[model samples]
Target: MDLTINDRVLVVFAEKAELPVAELDLDQTFEEIGLDSLHLMEVALWVQKEYGAVIPEGDLHHEQTVREALAYLDARTR
Candidate 1:
């Protein structure tokens, strides 16, 4: 089965956060998930490598929730 963009993004975040995918919520902010700036940078790198999309650090930092970030990336990838 093909993973949707949402699933893919969640998996990346979960992996980087060292938490189970089941533990992550789409409404949760990176801060709420215990992810720091370093983790966000790592996620940005993964987005660049995986989707060929260079998300600006400022934009990434501005994202309020996992869902919002995923939507931003999905827009760029498409």
Candidate 2:
């Protein structure tokens, strides 16, 4: 099965956060999932490696929800 961009992003975040993908909610902020700046940076690096997209530093913040972050990355990937 082909995973959509949202699914791929959720998988990355879930893996980094040490949580099950089923537990990740799109509306939940990164803070809510216990992901800090370091984790976000790691995720950004992963995105860079996986998609060749350079996510802006400002976009990786605690206030950004999973869905919003996915959208930002998805936009750049396309």
Candidate 3:
């Protein structure tokens, strides 16, 4: 599914982790989604696949918010 930044994060929370997007809080740490380090990698992989863009290796761990992740991608896509 084509998604905005918020949408992408929510989809990762939902589709991959089986959480409901509506239940996610924007300010909540992604930890609240219960992802471990491996899941973080999965999210990164999914993001890359969905966007057809590889997020830099380090940024995946650095970005703590959907908006920030999107900004990272936006900067790269330019």
Candidate 4:
């Protein structure tokens, strides 16, 4: 559970959505950067595969920001 990698994963998703690096604020919601449900599901799958963190469905709704996701993943890895 490398949090630095997890944080970079979040940024990669935002970058994939074509957002500028300067606008990739950790506190911003995924929706703020134009991530739809499908996009989020893809990100969830990536996290599961890359970090071995199993994120249940609908969990992303509870996490409104990248920081929140990082915290959730960090806790789960523990």
The predicted structure with the larger TM-score, 3 or 4, is: 4
Q: Which digits, one per residue and each the tens of the lDDT, describe model 2 over residues 1-78?
A: 999877888898999889999999889999999999999999888888988989878778999999899888889889
Q: Write the per-residue lDDT of candidate 3 for residues 3-33, one digit (tens) a residue.
A: 5665555677666556777776555545665
Task: Estimate, for each residue in 1-78, the C-alpha lDDT of model 4 and write its tens digit.
Answer: 654766667676666678776677778777776777777778778878877888887777624786786677667655
Question: Quick one: how many clashes does candidate 1 have?
Answer: 0
Which lDDT value does model 1 have at 65?
90
User: Scored by CA lDDT, what does every candidate get?
Assistant: 0.84, 0.90, 0.61, 0.72
Instruction: Give stretches of model 1 more than 4 Å off.
Output: none
Candidate 1 residues 1-78, lDDT tens each?
A: 998877888998998878999998889888888788888888888888988988887677634798888888899888
TM-score, per-candidate, Cα-based: 0.87, 0.90, 0.64, 0.74
- Report backbone clashes per prediction: 0, 0, 0, 0
> Model 2, residue 53: what's the lDDT?
89
The deviation in Å at residue 47 for candidate 3 is 1.7
CA RMSD of each candidate after superposition: 1.5, 1.1, 3.1, 3.0
Q: Global lDDT for candidate 1?
A: 0.84
Better structure of 2 and 3 per lDDT: 2
